[model samples]
Each structure stands twice: as structure tokens, then as C-alpha cells.
Target: MSHGLSIGDLAARTGLAVSAIRFYETHDIIKPVRNAGGHRRYGRSDIRRLSFVMAAQKLGFSLSEIAPHLHRLPDHKAPTKADWTRISTKFRKDIDARIDALEELRDKLDGCIGCGCLSLKSCALYNPGDMKAAEGAGPRNLTAITT
Candidate 1:
């Protein structure tokens, strides 16, 4: 007998669509084995793995960012507490950086809104003469805080 849960069973346990599970598989977030009949079979550990992925995504982590951490774990086996502790240590650093950035943005946003200069090119605040445009596209002023 194949020693694992079917894709459908994994999806039900994780509250994820089977398609989403497949998506994570593509990113190396989970690796399911194939039964003799060629059906995908997920180990019980995949439940915790997918659960961790779900929580990480909720915290704004992209799959690319998460893949490296999970890849270090043993495939088809539950991660040890030490394994999770290491990952969380890294995540905490990222979370701290994001918090600092958010605080900076909050402090700056008030000043920008209060300045009452709707014109980007003429704003004396962060981007005088739209000089931030030289930095590249996307919310240049907001994202340029650390850059």
C-alpha cells in the first residue's frame, strides 16, 4: 500500500485547493511521491508544510522567499522544532525590517498629505521636481525610503 495521503485528502486537510497545492509543488514548497498507479501521494508532514506556507503568505511572504527555508527540511517528514526555530529567526528579521519601513512610511505620509501639493513635479517634500522619477518606476518615493 502507498504510505501517504492523496492530493484530495491533503487539500481537504489543509483547506487548500488541489490546484494550489500543485502550485506550491512547482515552487518546491512540497514534494509528493507517486504511487504505483501514478497518483500523487503526500506525506502527513505536508499538512504542516502547507499550513506554514499559508501562514507565511498571510504575513506577505512570497513563495520565492519561502521556498529556500522549507527546502532545507527533510522531504516527506515533519520538520523538527529546531528546524522551525531557525526559519522563524530569519522571518523575525524580515518582519522587523518591514515594521521599520512601515513606520517610516506612516511618518512620511502625513507630511506629504498635509503639504497639500497634489502636483508631483512641484512637491517640495520627498520628491521635488519629480526627481524620484530618475530612480525608476513604481512608487518611487515611497519605496525609495531605504534606497
Candidate 2:
């Protein structure tokens, strides 16, 4: 049987600050057992949970977004392969959208950089529709560029 670990040990293992681990607990991402002295005691499975939390956060997933998936796994149990597959699919979709947007932006930048159009009115980066500037200027020449 795997014995529970102290909060300090968990922090050291995960390389996360004690407060961050506490924040995750407060968010209900990881629920550690409370000892008689009221000290938090995490189990071995917490190592995986904390790793997932850190990786998800680095990928720009909000706590609210990651909560449901993390909560699906019972305490002291690792998430199943199917659970990971589902999460991976969602993450892949998010990544694909970001990649598509970046590619479009790259194409637009390439076109604009090579065009040598310094004038904002003729610049494809600034104006894709070739919109003429109004007689009176506003605060910013806000032109919507549709990809």
C-alpha cells in the first residue's frame, strides 16, 4: 500500500511552491488527507495530478477548464487511458486552431513585408480591402482584416 506524503514532500517532488499546491487543493484539483494535527498529507497519486495540472496550465488551460477532467479521477487512482485520450483530443483541437491562426498571420505578414507598402491605407497588413481613409481621422485607423 502506498503511504501518504506530507505537503512539504509533495512540493519538493513536484518543484511547485507550497502555496501553489495549496491553491490547487483549494480549487479541488487535488484533495489531500488531513492528519490528526490538521496537516495536509498527499498520496503518491498526487505526483501525477500535480504534473497534469502544471502541464495543462502551461498549455493555457484555465483551472475551470481543467477541473472537470481532473475531478473525474478518484483519489489515489490514476486516470485511465480512455480519460487521457479524451483530454488529448480536446487539446489537439485547441492546438490545431492556434496553428491555423498562426499560419494565416504568417502568410499575411509575409505578403505585407514583401509588398513594401509603408502607407497604412495600401498596406495589406493594415488594410486588406484597400479601404480609403476617411477625410477626418479618428483616434486610431482601425481596419478589420479578415482572413
Candidate 3:
């Protein structure tokens, strides 16, 4: 019999629902071993892995984006502080860029809200009707902020 936490134990410790932990496993975010009776067994390290997954999700990183970095750490082993620092650096630049974009969008929103007409020459100061419409259909200023 393997001495490890049960799935319920892991869910309790991580404050994640059992179904959510199972979902994470489906994505390869966590791997639990099966005991002799065919019950899943999880080590303490899975706690940290689940926590990292939650934090990455909170930062607006998708599961696909988070998977590669999680692959670098050994399974069933706790990651060292250095390992976390190294992996998190990749996110810092991207998160910072997103923050900057959102801030710029917020600033531009004030001017755009003043007028609903992109047809206005004055409205063209931020988004010219012909230039924006030529590219695609949507508020050009907001698209520019995101893209």
C-alpha cells in the first residue's frame, strides 16, 4: 500500500473541489499514482502544484501557457524557490505588458466616450473612420488597445 494522501485529502488541503483536481489531472497539471486497490494517491508535492495552477490562472495565463513551465519541475517533488523564480520571470514581462495595455485602454476610453461617432473628424483624432473601418469592423481604439 502506498502511503500518500487520498484525492479527498488533497482537495481538502488545496481548498479545491475534488472534481476540479480531477480536471487538472486530465490536463496533465497533476499526476496521481494508483494504489494497490486502484485508488488514486497523491503526494504532498501535488498541493504546491495545484496552488501554482490556481495562481497562474488568476494571472490570466491559460492552461496551455502554464503547462510548459510545470513540465520543467520534477513530478512528485517540491520545486525549489529558484525554480519558481525562474519560471515566474517568463510571466512577469507578459503580465506587465497586459497591465500597461489595460491602463492605456482606460485612458483612451475617456476621450472615446465623449462622442459616439467615429465619423466625426474630431473622433478621428483617436480613430479615423476610414483608416479603422478599412482594417476591420469594430471600435478601432479599443482594438488597438488590445492588439
- Highest TM-score, which number? 3
What is the C-alpha lDDT profile of model 3 across 1-147, one tens digit per residue? 248899999999999999999999998888888888999999898898889889889888899999888888878777899988988898897788889878877877667632346655567675554455665666666675567
- How many steric overlaps does candidate 2 have? 0
The TM-scores, one per candidate, come to 0.80, 0.71, 0.83
Clashing pairs in 2: none
Question: Which candidate gets the maximum lDDT versus the true structure?
Answer: 1
Q: Tell me the tens digit of each residue's lDDT in model 2 across 28-113.
A: 88888777788778988889888988888897778898888788777766667887788778778776866776566666553442
Task: Tell me the RMSD of model 1 versus the true structure.
Answer: 3.5
Residue 109 Cα positional deviation in candidate 2, in Å, after optimal superposition: 3.8
lDDT of 2 at 20: 94
Candidate 3 lowest-lDDT run of ten: 112-121
**Where is model 1 poorest over a 10-residue stretch in terms of lDDT?**
113-122
Q: Judged by lDDT relative to the true structure, which candidate is superior, 2 or 3?
A: 3
Positional deviation of 112 in candidate 1, in angstroms? 2.2
Stretches of candidate 2 exceeding 4 Å from the true structure: 110-147
